[model samples]
Target: MSSSTVSRNSLEADQQWLLRSSSPENDLDRDERPSKPRRHIVAVLCLVLMFTVAGYVTSSVLLNNRLEHPFRIPKLPHEEPCDFAPSRPSWNSMPRHRRHAFISAVQRLASKPSRLGLSNTSMYDDFVYVHTKVVWQVHHHAISLPFHRYFVHIFEQALQNDGGYDGLMPYWDWTQDSSDPLASIVWDPWAGFGSAGNGCISDGVFARVGKFANYTENGYEPHCVTRNCLAHADAVDESDGVMHSKHWTPAIVKAIIDDSTTYRDFRQRLEEGPHKHLHAYGIGGDMASASSPNGQFIPQPKHTLSRIP
Candidate 1:
């Protein structure tokens, strides 16, 4: 009786072990089931985490761009031929207070740190940095006019957004003083650009600009606003006078406008004739070089917005 009972008990125990929850035979299937599901869950979690991080980064960049440039708003499809201001008024038309404001804005810009990190100079020198680097690339090509137009446009934007200048950039119509540029109001001491002495400009608001950055060769060099106004100096050209190009008379500029039929012809003539001549003419100061904006004779653009990309 005891042998039969013991044999039955052993058989029951073996069956119970086979059906146990932690048995190796059942564990094979359990392991296979969860392996694929766990792998899928981990991959999905990784993807979700990656997407979350990317979304946060993209949103942050967009927020920063909006904060930095509030004026840069996307135009709607219906907003065609956007025109805010019809005409650009010259500095002569600007009131005395506004003129002073422009000067103050420029001074404020010069006080700020350089954004380009190209030199220790102020933000104003950033234009000099760009203009100097792209001088050859922009100049002597069809892109010259548009490139310079871009310069004035960007510069004006910096002045407005950064320097807090509300007035439209001023354009100098130098043709008025083609006869005697030295006597021009553009060089007035108090309200206008102060005169020069000993070859370097010692007066005017721009007198603080004692250094300029040349990105092409040197980073920054100590320089001053100087004009080539040497009527009778040592080691000079006889043909050259107080001004560089006497050929840039009003008649010639008119001929370039009136005679040119094609766009290329017009641009070419304007760039070569009036443009180059004006730069090389009466006030051949820093305005004649890539560091033109750093000087008193800042060339303002009329229809430069159209040229910008």
Candidate 2:
């Protein structure tokens, strides 16, 4: 073979070898470039997933804490009742300003919308609704007195917390002025619970304030608090030979207190006696219905912190 031809063939063979090596290098570069991007994408996805899990865990923990320890207002030192002082007093014995303050608080609560829902017009309506709903379960049962006592407590709390009342709730001691209940001091037109009118109350602090929003007879209507005084005559013993008008007198209350030995006995006598009579005479309209307006006037047991115990 000629030397030039041999050299040319050798050069061509070298070129082919170089081309093959270059092709492999290009393929490796392309494959490696795509693999780097894939690795980067996987790392980013892992980071995003990790953050999502961390956030979920944090929120769950916070929610559980919130549920476990619900928010509440701490009681102040002054809220505790003094040992020597009376916690509740008769309505007639309450200070004039305190009575007015309570009345004003009730009016304020009556004006505010119910927290239960918008369907209920006012806070007073919510109370009436609750009474109506639970009337069957609470009345004429062992739980009656306890239920009513708790209910009154809740009402007093609302008066303080929501209505901004400062005085403790006062109860009407019907026996104190039972001789002439209609002319009782608590029925004064200027400063008391107001006197009975035709169908609705027309005098005193609660007069034509028109705030009660619900009633069994009339639902979701604006109306004033109502009262009606009914008088009854009781026949005397044959030896006495004279009949006289009767009222829920202190003597009856004394008898009940003296006669009652057990809680059930006390409840039965009180319920069947002065309690029933007061409801029959004191309230009219829906207040006199089977579902009583004043939760059947469950009397607090003598000398106790709570009406139930």
Candidate 3:
């Protein structure tokens, strides 16, 4: 054969051999292979969705049981016996030393290392994390009151155990100050949750004191815990120190309680009505946000207010 014809034939043979020897992946392209990342993302998404659904179902069942039997917590034999005798007094009724100690405990807890998650955070910040995280799930539902009650109890235990507080779980009885919420002893600069703020508080125990959680895109960032005691939506109450106290008069709260014909109704009304106003109008800042509990720098007032009964 001629040299030109022979070279063309050899090139064709080499091309065929190369194609035959290559694997299917090499024939197509390595980049065209199925994406492991996409599969992993799908698996992770499925797991997240499964856990979320399970959590919701479990929460619903537990909340329903809580509704049916509000005080049916299972206790160990060695656990402290239930005592109904110790009266849960209002914040106003607590003595100076008790209030001071409780405040100290709260501060100590806030200052301590995180017990819930992330060693970088404080134990109190853990409360803020869960409170902010589950606000949507627990609030505006049957679990609202019960969940908060349990949360407060756990917080109180933490205070006693970690903070060395040996006093009753304090709470703010808003009814006393509902007519003039600002003047309520809970805001006492010397002994209470410190003074109010237009933006961030500038005076009192928590003055310029930063918190580990502040409702940011990044879950935990140390910032000043806010208490906007002057913020109000009502044009009339906009500048009033009492804020929207008119809507929360003792009679108004009584009516809210009395008018609620069903448990759900009562819960819904209380959650959406005075409970909301007290946080939004009565005290603004973080309380107005999804994480209402983090609004106060001084949790003693928040704790005191949380103990409804």
TM of each candidate vs. truth = 0.64, 0.62, 0.68
lDDT string, candidate 3, 255-284, tens digits: 876787976777656755666566655565
Please identify which of the two predictions, 2 or 3, would achieve the higher lDDT against the true structure.
3
Residue by residue across 248-277, what tens digits does model 2's lDDT show? Answer: 466766777787897767765665555544
For residue 21, what is the lDDT in candidate 3?
26
Q: How high is the CA lDDT of each candidate model?
A: 0.50, 0.49, 0.56
The RMSD of every model to the true structure, in order and in angstroms, is 31.0, 35.8, 22.2
Residues 252-274, candidate 1: write the lDDT tens digits: 66786688896566765665555
TM-score order of candidates, top first: 3, 1, 2
Error of 2 at 102 (Å): 0.7
Which candidate's TM-score is highest? Answer: 3
Which candidate's lDDT is highest? 3
Q: Check candidate 2 and list the clashing pairs.
A: none
Candidate 1 wrongly placed segments (more than 4 Å): 1-80, 196-198, 208-218, 230-245, 300-309
